[model samples]
Target: MSGTSDLEFFNTQLRSFVPPGGFDAHAHLYRREDAVDALPRHVEDESGQVGWTAYSRALERWMGDRRPIDGLFFTVPKPALDRPAANRFVAQEVRPLAGSRMLLMIHPDDDPADIEAAAMSSPCVGLKVYHVYASRADTFNAAPGEFLPEWAWELAHEHGWLIMLHLVRVRALADPVNHDYVREHCRRYPNARLLLAHAGRGFCGQHTVEGIEALRGLDNVYFDTAGICESEPLKAILRTFGTRRLLFGTDFSVSEERGRCVSVADGFLWLSEHNVDWELSEFGRPTLIGIESLLALKQACRSARLIDADVERIVCCNARQLLGLRQAATNQTQVTYRRAKRLIPGGTQLLSKRPEMYAPDRWPAYFAEAQGCEVIDLDGHRYCDMTTSGIGSCLLGYADPDVNAAVIRRVELGSMCTLNSPDEKELAEVLIELHPWAEQVRFCRTGGESMAVAVRIARAHTGRDRIAFCGYHGWSDWYLAANLSDS
Candidate 1:
């Protein structure tokens, strides 16, 4: 049965987040009778269908109390089904809408001239190409010729049509063949624009971002945010392309996370519900990702320090520009502290140095350079060392000339290697000599780790588990774990 969860969720929960006239860059409208006749009976959602009639009703339902959205609708062609029939269905049913646009589906074997005539007749803005079909779902990888064939490119290049390419290589856009094909084709035929579907359909961490980066310097290439809800990938797309080249898409009529058949409305709700930084561990820290997944993109933009203008461009302006409607122009401080906040949760290794604990808004979150007792910000603003220098780590003050020189000399002599440096033993001996009572000394990476090691050694020596501390110490699970039961 068709799911109403999508319709209800969007109208009530997600409706508020969607911007007015926001364009859905990726969407589909296909005929049900054609699917029933051409496709095998094994496919789900085949008999119980939502044709253009149902889709129209759902669109109205989706806009119940929210502003209307403009959609770039395409005909999802079932292979072996009549291409002309599907194109005619989309043109007849979807093209009449106020702000809707259409893309014609072109098969590899179809005659380019005939398809061009059909496209011109329907007046589609672009052409859709799918390498993987439901009938041969098992065969995912396809050679360049087998997928679209050289003739398809010739037609698109000749007509200067936008090719909505859903590539099917193993690594998707990251695949060498796929990358080479897209870069070469886009470069060779500057008139033909390639819109990589689902951020090149690379769902893995940083794979999509890195893949897009590999095809850099091509002005004809662009990407869409359809079916993508991951925080990292979205941030990467925004940061790399600067929201100008990223068109807002939801891969409607399909699941955002999976390619399996699903309700069109579910795709919208899925992205909204799963909006969050999913990479973060929820073991001990408070959840950083918000519950309202629909609001995730807006929040992510804010987290990335993107201004409102850029966010607007990403959600609506970019899509408008792609459709030749409208456009906007292209649009941090913090050294270690600022960077660590974005890349590493909790920012600093120790919680004591967290800027939030201090004057977060006014705190100088990062430093460009430091020498002696002076600190310089990225803006070249200089200040004298006043507060605890580096949270009390720099006892002799930052960049002490004599101390830095000695450290540099040791580094030149190999600071760390498989064989221990002479300084390790010398430092231990010096510590022992200074304490006199202590028989040996050990080194650790952080004060917290060293404290935990000391506690472990003490517990092992006494054969006891329970221990007491007087006042404040470092942050270690041994001490903080007890605080878990305090409240």
Candidate 2:
């Protein structure tokens, strides 16, 4: 239903939102010009047509706003193609785009040391295992671990590299043997983090959910939403993985043609020595249906009610985190914090609560809820309050039941009205009774404000321009004035 190069249409659809610094987890870029000569007689004619410039234009169009995007670049796997040459092309080509990472295809027979040497010599961040291609099968139906070498895992574990895995067999999760094989392999190579392509290629939502559940306890396992556009499945992935393990991918090139009508002359579908047409012919007729990957993804996200935060995480945060690109992956929180520093003086209301007081770069400075010495952070992770319970204000502990109940009762009776509540006066009298020297008292919401009031009273009573105080007196103009002149 979509036109070729429908940039304008995509722009209109995405006008309301733009995820800044988003990463395309799955994308392709390579020099195919030389590969044409090496390809088989039948399909060799099809090679060398798509160049990097055309690829760049397509990326610009996909990016929509002409703003560059980061991606994990790869070369499409083919039998006759020189794998090392492809890796060299991607590494050299993507050097300018420092945000992008490269993943090269690794076969079982490839020497691990040579692969490692090549990786070290290039800008590669990981390896991709094309199960179907490596197995020399028309479709992915064999167990991945059955063919993958242990040396690949050892190298990845040593260097902390990612393995962009595409599993074989449609019912991978349902098949216990396949699931256990992968589970055991992951356990053996704990450091070689794996990201499943196309949500393990589960076409249906329930199957996708089941497949994700299969790798439930594997902390290093990840997934990407590329050719998958089903809303229910997207929702299931988001719900199960929490956006941290789900990466955003368009599967580029392939996604560019997705869901678009293609003529018989298209090299990908028509010209192939491997029974290209007959093998793909559905029973009797020659028909082709495109998968509108990008459009469908946007629609799925909208349908799933995923907010900007989740979208940003999937499109940017997760990839950056996985790649250990902390400097490059500017998340929504960092963006907001940067803006706040420019707009808000000192960046926050309370100096102590400023991001610097905690992990600074890593700490989540915002909270959603606080109850009984526990805090739920902005990202929904809860933590126990072991540190000084709100600067020691909560002497009875945070959110004490008795204290909350009294406050609730007072609110129910009437927190404020034409006259002050008797409780304030009773408390003042009680304080005086407890300490005879304390004749008067004032109730203020914060210690800092109370300290400012006290400073003003001291200045007024003593009729002095300077006053001396010991210890930290909080952030108040009165205290700040003392430091106006050099001691």
Count of backbone clashes, every candidate in sequence: 3, 3
Q: Candidate 2 on 261-340: residue-level lDDT in tens?
A: 11222111222233344546456331111134445556667755678876777777778778977543335455567788
TM-score of each: 0.54, 0.59
- What C-alpha lDDT, on a 0 to 100 scale, does residue 437 get in candidate 1? 100
The residue-by-residue lDDT of candidate 1 on 1-487, one tens digit each, is 1225445655565565565566767866665654534222222244444444545444443344332266677766555677777788778866566566788887776787888887788747778877654235554677444566677677767877778887665666667888888888888887777888776764542556567666755667777766555655566665444556677665545532221211232121232223544347454221111112234465556656776556566667776666665532311444545667788778866666676876874566667557546675544355677888887878787766578669777877778788867778999998998999999888998777888888889888998766677666755546656435545
Q: In model 1, which residue pairs have backbone atoms overlapping below 3 Å?
A: 226-249, 272-293, 272-294
Candidate 2 colliding pairs: 258-291, 259-290, 259-291
RMSD (Cα, Å) of model 2: 12.9
Candidate 1: regions farther than 4 A off:
1-16, 34-53, 59-68, 133-138, 255-296, 327-487
How does candidate 1 fare on TM-score?
A: 0.54
Report lDDT (Cα) of residue 15, candidate 1: 61
Candidate 2, position 291, lDDT: 30
lDDT of 2: 0.66
